[model samples]
Target chain A: MLAGGHGNSNPNTNYLKSRGLWVAYSIGMLVLHLILLSIPPLSIPMAWTLTNQVHNAITFIVLHILKGVPWIPTDQGATSLLTHWEQIDEGRQFTKTRKFLTASPVLLFFLTCFYTVYEPHHFVANFLSVCLVTLPKLPLFHKVRLFGINKY
Target chain B: MDILEPMYTLVFTELVPSFHVHLQVLLGLLVLWVLFKKSEKPGRPGKAGKSELDIINDWKPEPLVTPVPAKHRGLNAPVTKNQIAQHITVNGVKCLNFATNNYLALVNQQEIDDVAVAAIRKYGVGSCGPRGFFGTVDVHLELEEKLAQFMRTEAAVVYSYGFSTIASAIPAYAKRGDICFVDEAVNFSIQQGLVASRSHIKYFKHNDMMHLEQLLSEQAVLDRKNPKKAAKTRKFLIVEGLYNKTGEMCPLPEIVDLKNRHKVRLFIDESISFGTLGDTGRGITEYYNIPIEEIDLVMSSMEGSLGSIGGFCVGTTFVVEHQVLSGLGYCFSASLPPLLTVGATAALNLMDGNPDLVKELNEKCDQLHRLLHKSETLARYFRISGCRLSPVKHLFPLELKSGTENELQKIVDLCLQDGVALAVPAFQLNDVKFQTPSIRLTVNSKLEAQDMSKCLSTLEKTVIATFKPTSTS
Candidate 1:
């Protein structure tokens, strides 16, 4: 009975794990974008190093940690955890809408920062004030299913 | 400082810090991953077989077949031609059968028809399975027994078709380490067998004995080290008895004598020569009076001249038995239908009965060759004589001027339009095409003397019309 049940469970777990890896990669990119925006202006080069270059360097180690940490919720059943994690279509739509709405504001913020550095203008100050006001309306990104710290 | 040290320092300084970090870390990880993967799946006991993933990666979809030109569109489309006696009616008008391989005029012969009908009645329609199981009919066994007697060998085996006999026989003998020495101009069927068997193979120049000797010498050295692994190694000399392209006999007596002296076994594919050479048409072995006993193996397609649909091989009992046991083409495939065997059996009997018919065929070939040689239009392209046509029967080569086979085909097509059947592009192969001097006009016993004359006259006219001398501008 143990052998038969284990045989049945093995393929399902393997398939779920493979798909989970893709999700983790996408979430990692999102986290990198968020951290870049949150960083100080003068440290932009340092932030670039931390996000893209540093992340790339330690990605293998992170992936190993992600795979080892079991994602299934201890309190909830395995089915509930699988269902939450497998909601890819819903997550993609949310990400798409969030990106479209935030695009102009993100672009304006970067442009204003650059111009302030190159050619100082009141337009840069005005843009920063407008960005701060609009921050309240920014859609909150909620992690629906947390596997582990490295994966989340 | 060393010159190499300065170069290395310059390369190291130029690389970006991020790139250097990524390269060192990622390269190590990638190497480790590959090593882990290799360790998990140790390769095959022998060499690694081609994987499905490899096949998929290498897959190249075939390019589409080119569409026919608007003018030539009807060439590929089927036409329901009303075939008549001595004339093929196409588009409701009478034309000749230039593409037909009805050499002996045996297709509709009363004697042949009667024999075929009787055999079909006696032995149902088909044996319906392979010879190993229920496919072997009494007639099939009898045919093989008779073929062995005819070819004058110890034993014989019949195959469902001409190509399968060739495709089966070569591989049945050749294994992993065997080296097959083949003629460059060999039929595609033999080539397929050699390739599918995965044996080491080499090619000699077309009809070049010296080139063959050189290849054999090269093989002898390779064989010495491995000794070709007794189970895997055999050196086979494969060539045709009568080259279907030239319609000329192989220098078999010479080939056989040379191969024997060099300790290599020879297998002669006498598809074209059988039923058209020798006193009784046993084939090239007898045509040259080289004892069949001296030749290692003989294979024949009973299609072109024999008016049948299958192939047969004659050799020692051991070889014949071995082929029956392991020849995948024979073992996996269904056996030849009994009706075709009936027809072949009839053809063999008829060939045995009619000695004079063979003599008449020789005479007809002689007459046709002489007439074609005399024709001013054909004389330039066709270099043939009486001896080449046949000593005992009608078969000769039409050696064309280089790259004129298509032009010869056009003339043949014109002959067809004028109600005379002609054979022009007889054998087509890679880098080689055989254009007969005149169409292979067989003077079968069935055709009246008048009919023969009319055919010759029509041929002469077609030649004249097709190749009118290019006037000097």
Candidate 2:
């Protein structure tokens, strides 16, 4: 199977199921917050907001926008039309990885709210960002694309 | 900054019960992290005592056996819904099938079907065991005798599967420390055989005689240096009759000449050519009018022309008899079903009776070649390939910049809509780094000139419509 280089399919799902993935993700979130806090002008609240927002934006692009595994041709364009989120666990929901992924953003949002003291502006930004990451993970709108954006 | 005292009080009081799942999740994550660290502890670089554990951890097992195709994928490509024929139903739509390797157009033959039915009643659908066991049905012997008689060889052995015929036949003779000279464009079956043989392989450019000669000469120089070892080592020259990758026919006479000069065993895989080439459908040897005895080994699959399930190898009794024990698939795997064996025997009987069918197939191939190559209409769009009378034809798009773009697939899809089924298979043939994917169309004796014309016109319309005329033109 390695005749075609790098035979791994859905590398994202593989990493998600891996033991240290959530720990690494939490550490990454902490690292992002620390980097933002190190800025001279930023307060802890501002850093928390920025960290959640940055994390959400990256996740939105990666899990939602990116479609198909580029390394192997095994699936024969089966994953071409599917986003990474839709491709996860072959579209099965409520699996451990999906639950963890769903829980992660919500946990980050809770932390952001606590750090920002539930400020209206910070709450809105974190709420929208968390919604962006987690709503697509819902089974209701699993493969539904609104308004044909990135539909191709 | 303020310490957010209200948030701490809120978490301790109001949200404590509500965050039940979260507490368990955090605890689970921490435990998982600790477990992950412990699992990785053996791999620390400074440890000298744990080399054995490191080796076990690092080892990634390669697949040693072929993964049984997941209850799908027939012997060849192009999964069909109904009985395979010139016209096939794919995804509920019947289209003129130019995809399958059914070259002799032996489909829906009442006689062949009758034989299969009769045999099934007598011997059941399966032989149930390998050839040495109860697998050796009466019809299996009959088919082997028929094949040997047809090929004018002293003996023949039938393989339960088409691909296994070549894969097993090669290693039965050529073993480790032996050498194989193979053509570059040979299909995956031949490649599998070469790999299984564990023989030193030297691949020459596809059908390049000079390169083959040069390799032979280089081996000769090595032989001069070590005559004792050279005398013990057997040499094999392997080539496909009509290559599966490209439809290009190997120059058999020249190849035979080379085999004689080099004193190498000439093994020709006539899988696609048998029962499709020559006036009498006797295969590549007959096409060139060369005696069948000249080739040390001839392997032909019954799936293509004979319209059956298995494959067979023809040679002297001494050579083929070795495969009964040495050929892995022959001894280990269940033999071909009695009905399929009877089916192949009937198909051969029909071929022996009807020489006109083979002639008709060649004529159809010629007409296709003429339409695609003689007329300059498709020249801008494609580079026509294969020998003049080759049953298989390829249309490699000259205009397409990259194979990944798959303009050919779009054209195939559009043609399929117009009732013309074509294949641009992600062929498990040849390496992909430099090879351009082409539309593989197999010509059958059953297709009339008008039907083929309609197929080509649909293809032309689709090609023009899919890509810019100027770009393709």
Candidate 3:
């Protein structure tokens, strides 16, 4: 077990609770972005720009909130877990692969944003697509184990 | 793009026109407020009503083990105002100082002051940035080169502060998986460095080479059991050239022999011994007639012996160069001020010019040791502890009465009242291992024969008065 007691036996319930909270946070952020998009003072391009800004702001705030939640591990906790696992060769390799997999969605979202900046016509589609891509990377959702298999 | 254009126009021209931006702002604020309010409510279902502050208020801090006296609660009287020489004014009284580390009494030397003043005029007080970022002035390089030359090493690296030099150097090379064999009686700075390294540390009895060898043999047995792990693990032996806590010199010859026999790297901290030990004062290596190249690294603080404000590590070029990129404090902290570096440079020049000063300091240490050793009054109350050559001496009580430290403090207070200054060695409360309460006296070269006699007379009187013998029935 890690210092934070992250390797508890009741993984299924903990994973579900964390996944549920992450889903709720992601939906709340999406609704906030949509509301900013529907504002009358913003033109189509302006609305799209406002939506991306709201997306970043809401994600940051929600991640901070998730850090305080017990079931979801904070970045510091994850780093400690990485260090603990690094003592063993197999576990170190596992952690490295897990980190790369975990980072892919955020990397993809930034790449999509970069391309959408030059082609503004697909801005709304790109924004929604990025939001969808980020869902699996959320604090709680990232911890979810499917069919008795741990994803992280 | 075409479908989105019509949709964008419809939303902007028709749908969004009915709703104002202000209302949208208010709606967004309301949603955020509700979300935050929900989060502010406790996550635990049963404890939703209690506020966060209420939980924090219920928490209590751990009580101190030994509560400090109310009179000593705040800052004590400032110890440094004028130069830390043989005589210093503390709380406006000129007292014979036996406390400061101005061993050679070069803190207020005319030549050093002149050079410092000149350097300040040329380069300002502060370095403004770390060494990597425009902080490396010419004086810093000069000091490093001079230090390397003086210590007879291929290269050396200077640290901005004395304490961080060893702390950063240890971790820079010895990472988590490595093993370190340390002496228990090393000063706090070395302890901090060992902690920072995160390496497997096995502490032997202080200055006990037999115990150290036993530990090494046991480690060898463990290594033989797992040959692959042993091959990968880097072993290091760390000891102080002159131990500050116990005020004794390390047996360096045996340590060097052990280092070769065990194939362990040797790192010696010569903070107290540098410019204080040896005939000409190159350090323990010179004092013991051991070649400097045998030791993997030699670290010393310029503050103690050189009467300056920084530290340096002397080693081969390859080892010293690694610290530039790896040593955290050297890379992160602002470089040593140009004035202080130049001051150290001047002091080095003085030592180089007059090697007799080092010789004189050694003679003074010996004289003071003999004077204290022969005092009947001191012999009745306390046992003097330290090497004859070490300037720093410890007076450990022969018998520990329940409140011996308080009694020692009373003697120190009385000595101060009588115009003689002494120091009570203080350690962190967490460090329960080597906390033998003793009065520490520092002997300097500037002290005349009469001055030593006067200080010894005052100490004898104070100790006798504090711990007067009671006749047995």
Candidate 4:
């Protein structure tokens, strides 16, 4: 009777609940995704199908929860799952960094507005600020910094 | 000035609430700025604390751990020539000719070298500046034309790398208010392109058409709802001809059909498949028999297959010319080195000359796959796909079989010690994880059967030793 009580009253119940919430949220995302498909004037979907999206959503949800558990590290089931997660994250970061660099022009437009408001009369300050924010995004700027600005 | 009177009134009289509020906000921001200054790092105020050379001399190269004979011995020990490979000697080792990206063995070939040399002599070195800034040379045009012909497209523009190819091209062609539907398994480059653009991007799961369809449907609804607000001209479906990590063929024919029926534009990245697929190594467009016209944009890196140093995108003349002039990569960086361009052009030419290269590559893939499957120790956990070496290579997942990254690393170490180079990938989708852990073995046409057999034997020994329970180090 005592053993059963301890098992039932374990604090991991909250952890499991949180895990369950994540899972449910993932499922809901899949449903939302499905609903998104039905509402559209969508003409052509790419290589990915609705079923694949759901499968990936399920995969991501399960992997995220498992990654948080300490015991997960040693377990075979959780280990490979975690590896896949690392790969995906690495890919995402790589892609994101490049996009951020290219999108600097768009970001500069916002910075320009901010500059106009912050330093209204100082022409040199606004020009320098715009240059500072936009320079690093250009491939030429990156190369110059990497190789030396005076190298050419 | 008239502006001074208004400013004076705001500071002195406080006549307008709007002016008074703006002044107060400005004062608050100045106070916050002063506060932030106090939190910065405190460095020596006057002179350097010590000589830079003195600090440098004191620094020591500390080893992570004392060398372990079973695992790390090879890394530290002086390697002899025979240990690495035949006909290739690097760093005093005749390293096994396994680590090269010379898929068709065309990079160093005499024919390729001659063409490259000829182009260099004719064009001179360097495009001098960005494509937008007098960098476009006759050689560059010739290369682009050749690429268009090879890919069977109307026009093509080259970039520095596969990452730049996608990042630069997609954003140039598509814009904000436009919708781009991407494959979950798409490369980092494609993702970069999407993020750079102002378009609303929807991600579908790996190889999931239904999800993509749904996304399109949703976008259509959104467009209809706000038809007058944001002017969106068209939707694009983007994917790779071959996924980089997973050696699986994309459902190209199906995707093409979808594009035709749905009136959506299709973009394909054929970096992996360019020289390793189809009869003439023309890539997925050829393999699937999809018309070149159906593919609005084609992007690929010449690094992996052609063994060169850049990437390219083929499309309509308008799009290609525009991308050349306005794409961020084209407008920013120096054009490809004349030598690299010539080498790539020569590689493409070689493929045209030797139709059997693809056939030979397919056989190497098959043999390697068969040998791994037949291995007693490796067969249990490792799965090898067929000999075709599809768009991404064969999807032999290491993490899936080893159960953990640590175990996967150990297995990888064993193979490395035995002199086999493998590609270990950390790949993700929609912020989730996945690893197509199998080594990316890029087989060259010139490699002998013995070379492959030796590599396989080393892999077998490594696997057996790693899995053997009783074998003490």
State candidate 2's DockQ: 0.02
Ranking by TM-score: 3, 2, 1, 4
How many residue pairs collide in each prediction? Answer: 1, 0, 0, 31
For model 2, residues B239-343, the per-residue Cα lDDT tens digits are 999987789999999999989998999999999899988889999999999998899989988889998888999999998887887677897799999988988
Q: Write the per-residue lDDT of candidate 4 for residues B242-312, one digit (tens) a residue.
A: 77655667788878877887678898888777888777888888877877788888888888778778899
lDDT of 3 by residue, B383-428 (tens): 8988999989999988887888878888887888788888888787
Better of 2 and 3 by lDDT: 2
Question: Candidate 1 residues A1-152, lDDT tens each?
Answer: 11113334223223423436555755766687567758667354344333433343343233222321133121112222222212222222223322322333333333333323322233334344434422322323233323433222
TM-score (chain B) for model 3? 0.85
What's the distance in Å from true for residue A6, model 4?
70
Model 4, residue B258: what's the lDDT? 78
- Residue B280 accuracy (lDDT) in model 2: 95
Candidate 1 lDDT over B1-473, as tens digits, reads: 57357445544665323443343354345333433332223344444688868867888888687666764424743243643234556445465443444445556666766766786688767777888888888888888888887677899988988988887888777655567888875666777777766677888877888888888877667667654243245678889876654455567766887788667779889776776677677777777888887777788788766777889889999878777766766776788888788788878877878766555555555565565556664455455433444422222324445545556666666666666655543342342322243345433434455555666677667666655563222
Location of the lowest summed lDDT over 10 successive residues in candidate 3 chain B:
B33-42
Per-model C-alpha RMSD: 21.2, 22.9, 13.6, 22.4
Please list the residue runs of candidate 1 whose C-alpha ends up more than 4 Å from where it truly belongs after superposition.
A1-152, B1-99, B118-124, B221-232, B382-387, B390-406, B424-453, B469-473
Instruction: Candidate 4: list runs displaced more than 4 Å.
Output: A1-152, B1-92, B117-125, B221-233, B373-376, B385-387, B391-403, B426-438, B470-473
Q: In order, what DockQ does each candidate have?
A: 0.01, 0.02, 0.04, 0.01
